[model samples]
Target: MSAGTSQETPATARGGLFVTFEGIDGSGKSTQCRMLADTLRARGLDVVLTREPGGSDGAEEIRRLVLEGDPDRWSAETELLLFTAARRDHLERRILPALAAGQVVVCDRFADSTRMYQGLSRGDLRASVDQLHRLMIGHEPDLTILIDMDPAKGLARAKGRQGSEERFEDFGLDLQQRMRAGFLALAQEFANRFRVIDGDRPMDVVAQDVLDVVAAALPERDGDAGA
Candidate 1:
C-alpha cells in the first residue's frame, strides 16, 4: 500500500497491533518499546518487538551502512533512500508477517523518524521525503508513542550510549533540537495515531505511562489462531 493511502479495516483486522515508537535520540523509545512488548507478552498477548533500519536481515545490513559510517557518508537524499529501503525490508520480512500472525509488533522507530531526521538536517528535502514515502511506503502504525524530552538531556543520554551507530547522534545538539521540534510537530499532524509521552521522568514512571496508553488502545485478541 502507498503511504498516502489509508486502510479502512482496523489494524486488528490483520490480527495484531502495529505500534511504533518515535522520538529524538535518547528519548528512551527503545527501552519503552521493549518494556511494552515484554509486558504485553506476559499478559498472554503474542508480541514481536522489533526496530527500524535493522529489523530484518536485509534491513540490518542497510542499517550498518547508514549508522556506522562517517557522519557524511551519505548525502541527505541518499540517506533517506537507505532508510526507506530498510523500512520496506522490515515491513515485508518481519512487521507485516508478525502482524498477520496476530502478534503485537512494537517497533523502536518508524517513518516518522525518517521524516524528522531528514527534514531537520536537509531542511529543503522534507517534501521529497513525504513524496518518497507516499510512493514507496505508505503504512503507519496503529499507535505511535512519541517520547518527548529536552534536546540537551536527550543528546547527553545518546552520547553516553555504547555503540558505533552514532551517525545521527554525531550531528551534535543543534540538529537534535530541531529534530525534537519536528517530532512534536508531527505528533500534532498525526494526532489520531500518536500519543506524546513525557520522557524526562524516572524510567519506571515513564514505562507505566507507556503501558497506560497502550493498554487503553490495544485490541482484544479474540483467540486469533494467528496470534
Candidate 2:
C-alpha cells in the first residue's frame, strides 16, 4: 500500500469520513448526497450535508458573486479566487468542525469541481487553483463520486429545472465535454479515492449504487461489502 492508503486505514483514523460528489450540471449529485447522508444517519452515524461555493454564510455571498454576477465583471481568475474564498470559509467554519465532532460530511461538490470546471475551462488557472485547493482543503475526500453522463442529456435536465442557463451553464457543449473528460481523468489519477457512476440511470438506482459504494468504502462496514 502507498503511504496515503496506509494512513487512511479506518482502524487507525478517528476523523469523520469526508465524502464528496462531483459531476456536470443536473448529474443528480445533490440528490445522491442527501440520500447517502440519510442512509448513514439511519445507521446511527452523525451526518452533515453541505455543498461547495456556499456552505457557510460568507461562502454564500461569494457564491452569489460568482453565480449571479454579470459575466463581464469577473474574469476566470477572479471567479477562481471567489470560489477559493468560499471554500476557505466552508472548510474553516463548517467542514472541519463537523469532522472534528465525528460526523460524516457529505458535500455535493468540492475541490474536484474546481479542477474540472475552473481548471479545465480556463486552462491557465489550473495550477493556481490546485495550489489553493491543497492549501485550503489540506486533505482530499475519503471518497469522491463522479456521476458521469453525456453532456447533452445532463444539460437538458438542468435546463428543464433551471429554465435559463447561468454563465457557467451557458458555456455550451464544447466546454461541458472538456469538463467531463477532466473529471474522468481526475478519477483515473486518484483511483483509490474515486468512483464513477453512470448518471444516465434512474435517480433511485443511482442513489442505491452510491449508497453501496459508500457502504463498501467505510472501514467499519467492510464485512457488509454488498450493501
Candidate 3:
C-alpha cells in the first residue's frame, strides 16, 4: 500500500479504536502502552501492541534506515517519505486489520510524533509533512496520551537504561526542548482527543492516570472487568 492510496471502509466496519502514546524519550510510552494493552486484553478485548517507524516488515526496514543510517545521507524530505512509507504499510497490514477485527490498537507513537519531530523540528517542511499525514493516514487516534516530562530528566533515564544514545537522542537538549514544545502545541490543538499526563510522577501513578483516561474515553468498556 502506497502512502497516497486510501483504504476506505465503512465507519461501522471500523469496529475498534486506535490509541497512540506520544512523548519524548524515557517518558514511559513503551511501558504505558504495554500496560494499557494488557489491561484491555484482561477485559476480554482483543488488543494489538505496535509502534511507529517499525511495525510491519517494510516499516521495520525503514526504521533501521531512519534510526541508524548515515545522518548526512538523508534530507528532511527523504526522512518524511520513508516514515510515511512505513506508516502506510503498517496501517494496511497491521493497524487497519486489527481495528477491523474489533481489537483495540495501542501504538507507542504515530503521526503526532512525525508532526513534532520531523515536521516542526525542520520548520520549513512542517506544512508538507502535515499534508502527507492527511493524504496517508486520514484517521486519527480515538485518544492520545501525551506523557509530559522534562526532557533532561527523561534523557537521563533513557541514558541509564540504554547506556548510549541513538542518532535522534544525540540531537542534544535544544532539539528535545523544541520537540517538547511541538508536542504541547499539538496537544492543545487536539484537546478533545489528547490527554496530557505528568510523567514525572511514579510509574504506578502514571499507569493509573493513563488507565483513568482510557476508561473515560471508552466508557462502554467500563463494565468489562479485567481477567
Candidate 4:
C-alpha cells in the first residue's frame, strides 16, 4: 500500500479495466479469471486474458525456469528478481498494450502473488517487494479478486493438479497457510481494490460471485453498456 500515493495510469491509458485474480495456491482464481474473460468477451468487450510470470513470450520463458524446478532451486532474492523481470516483460508486451488500447486485462496472478510468496514466506522482504514494485512496476490492478479458501483444502487441490509447476506447491501446507494469511492481510492493506470471495463453494457458484463483483466494477463501454 504505497501509503495511498500511486502514479495514475500511464497517459496512453484509456478507460481500460485491469483485473487480476490472486489467492493462495489452488484457490481457483485462474478458473475465475478465465470465466470472467469469457463472460466479458461475450458482452463484446475487448478483454485481454493474460497471466503474470508467463503472459508474453519472454515471460513465458522465465516461467519455465521459476515454476518447473525444485522448490529451492532459487533463493528468495533471486526468485524475486526473476519474477520481476518476467512481470516487466509481461506488462511491457502484453498488459500495458492491451490497457492502452482500452481492452480489459484479466490476469491470473500479478505482483501481489510475489508480494506474499517471496516477500513473506521466506523472510520479511515485504519492503523490498514494495520498493521494487514502486520503482519498476508503478501500477496496480483496477480490481483484484481474491478467492479465499482453507489452506488444507487448497493444498490438496494444488497437489492433485500434479502439474510441472508444482515447485511452489512442493513447499507444503505450512507455506500455503502462511500465504493464505498473507493474502488476507494484503486485502486489508489494499482494501480499495481488493474483493474477497469464498472459494469453498461450488465452482459455478463461486464463478457467479466473481462475475457479479467484476460486472459492477467494469466501466460501461459502448457495446458493453451493461454486463
Q: How many clashes (backbone N, Cα, C below 3 Å) per candidate?
A: 4, 0, 0, 0
Measured on C-alpha atoms, candidate 2 has an lDDT of 0.78
| Better structure of 3 and 4 per lDDT | 4
Worst 10 residues of 4 by lDDT: 3-12
lDDT of 2 by residue, 143-221 (tens): 8999999988877777678642266777667777888888998898778888999989888899889988887766573
* Winning candidate number (TM-score): 4
Worst 10 residues of 3 by lDDT: 3-12
- TM-score for model 1? 0.91
- Give me the displacement of residue 89 in model 4, in angstroms: 0.5
lDDT of each: 0.83, 0.78, 0.79, 0.86
lDDT of 4 at 29: 88
Candidate 2's C-alpha runs over 4 A off are 1-14, 163-165, 221-227
Q: What digit string (tens of lDDT, one per residue) describes model 3 on residues 1-227?
A: 43223343322247777889999877888899999888878877778999988889999988888877344557777888989999999999999898787777899999888887788885567777767877886777788999998999877776567632266776667777888888998898777678999999988899888988877765365434432
List candidate 1 segments past 4 Å from native: 1-10, 222-227
Which runs of model 3 end up more than 4 angstroms from their true locations?
1-13, 163-165, 219-227
The per-prediction CA RMSD against the true structure, in angstroms, equals 3.3, 3.5, 4.0, 1.9
Sort by TM-score, best first: 4, 1, 3, 2
Per-candidate TM equals: 0.91, 0.88, 0.89, 0.94
Error of 1 at 75 (Å): 0.6
